[model samples]
Target: MGCEAPATVGKLVAVNTSGSYLWEVPLETEKPSGGFGCAPAAIPAAIYGTPAVEVEEGLVYVGSYNGKIYAINSSSGALRWVYPREGNLQPVVGGAVVALGRVYIGSSSGTLYALDAVTGDKEWEFQTGDKIWSTST
Candidate 1:
């Protein structure tokens, strides 16, 4: 996802999954700024799930295709923590369902995980049949 800085007008933020970098670009009226502003932030991997979820204390949670979920500082794009899942799973395209301080997500491995919303900690896992693709509460 891309966004402009709320404080600075015309400044843009771009997240690149393939390049694993977050770019900050300042929009200039006179000429092109060459897409430069702040340092590039490194993402966990390709993002495939729900976009970053803004939470309390200026934190943002994002899930990626690397089988890892990340909590990063929204303002600085600094990583606070990451929760890794089983990597061998094919993929999880359904995204995450957050409720009551918990995150629910399903993987192509035919399993579901309940995790702590704030810390990205896994609380439980439920395995389903091979024919099942996903589940919900």
Candidate 2:
């Protein structure tokens, strides 16, 4: 499962059905930046929703409040890839869906993204007028 706390970094935690910890992967941490005059000046990247697990591929997909989606190795707890290339921030409040060899997720920036499951390369994006905070169905 994925877990995170406010003002702290996110984590991909693996636990058995009995609730024993197996392993964990730490996510990227962001420093506080000047808000647009209303929001908090500083913000930390965090996981705010559930993760999508592809057991057959041994991968887990999760979105972060920091505007990133990650693919993590289930067995080794290693990071596979992150979406949006780099140096871009698009807070994702929704859970991700892995299907048809793609990862689908929405962002607070009001965009729905389709990314390559293996390389995290963006395949397509659709923009909305408002933030996309709902999970993909």
Candidate 3:
């Protein structure tokens, strides 16, 4: 799936599984900024689920099947930080939540993690009987 900003002259983001990529399209130019607009950099492993929580400034948080969560710059599609999964589980399907200077999301292994929103550093994690399929704040 793909999503574009609400026509306020910002970037558009599209995710596909074929190449594990994130593609960006400038609204005015219609020029594709391939692979999250990082030309020389490696493509993302696989973007899953829509990005959640466009936080302060240009920061946006998204989860991936690469078993990690990424904080990306909204306008430029640049990588700000990466939070890798520590447990033996993937971090897709369940979306992420941002609140009170932290990001919250669940893993497929029935665990939920709270991290510093800016740094991608783990603050805490709580495990539940069933996996957290969704979240809100």
Candidate 4:
């Protein structure tokens, strides 16, 4: 994956087992700047881990360091949906997993989220005492 600071643009690259580039999917647009009255602006979204692929569904799930999860079409490299449906400031350092028709991912905020695989709807969320930066088994 290619990621640059201050820019939300990142690429989810697919490589064949033979070390060949298969395809690449672009991430979200440039991140907006916002914070408390005088607090510093938050960092842009960036990919920091591997993506989870659901071969049966032809979908790939990836999380950004800026706290957004994306669902992309495996064959077309097109974006399907993004979690939170609005904001992009939650740092999701962990990878996502797909199972039972849902996508599971965690964030630096210590929240584990379960989203509908097809609709990107929030099914439920669990808060933890610390950040979850690893893939949920």
TM-score of 1: 0.54
Best TM-score among the predictions, by candidate number: 2
Worst 10 residues of 3 by lDDT: 26-35
Worst 10 residues of 2 by lDDT: 32-41
Q: Model 4, range 1-137, lDDT digits (tens) per residue?
A: 43334322456677678977777876664663432111144344556667889998899988986567889888888789988888763677768888999999988778899999987899999998887868888
Worst 10 residues of 1 by lDDT: 27-36
- Against the correct fold, how does model 3 do in TM-score? 0.61
- lDDT string, candidate 2, 1-137, tens digits: 43233333346678889988777888777752422212233345556568999998899999877677889898888989887657755777789998999999988889888998888999999888788877888
> Model 4: how large is the Cα RMSD against the reference?
5.5
Error of 1 at 16 (Å): 14
Pairs that collide in candidate 1 are none
> C-alpha displacement of 66 in model 4, angstroms?
2.1
Tell me the lDDT of candidate 4.
0.75
Candidate 1 on 17-59: residue-level lDDT in tens?
A: 5754464433222222222222242222334455446566565
lDDT of 4 at 82: 85
Clashes of each: 0, 3, 0, 4
Per-model TM values vs. the true structure:
0.54, 0.82, 0.61, 0.77
lDDT scores of the candidates, listed in order: 0.54, 0.76, 0.60, 0.75
Q: Report the candidate with higher lDDT, 3 versus 4.
A: 4
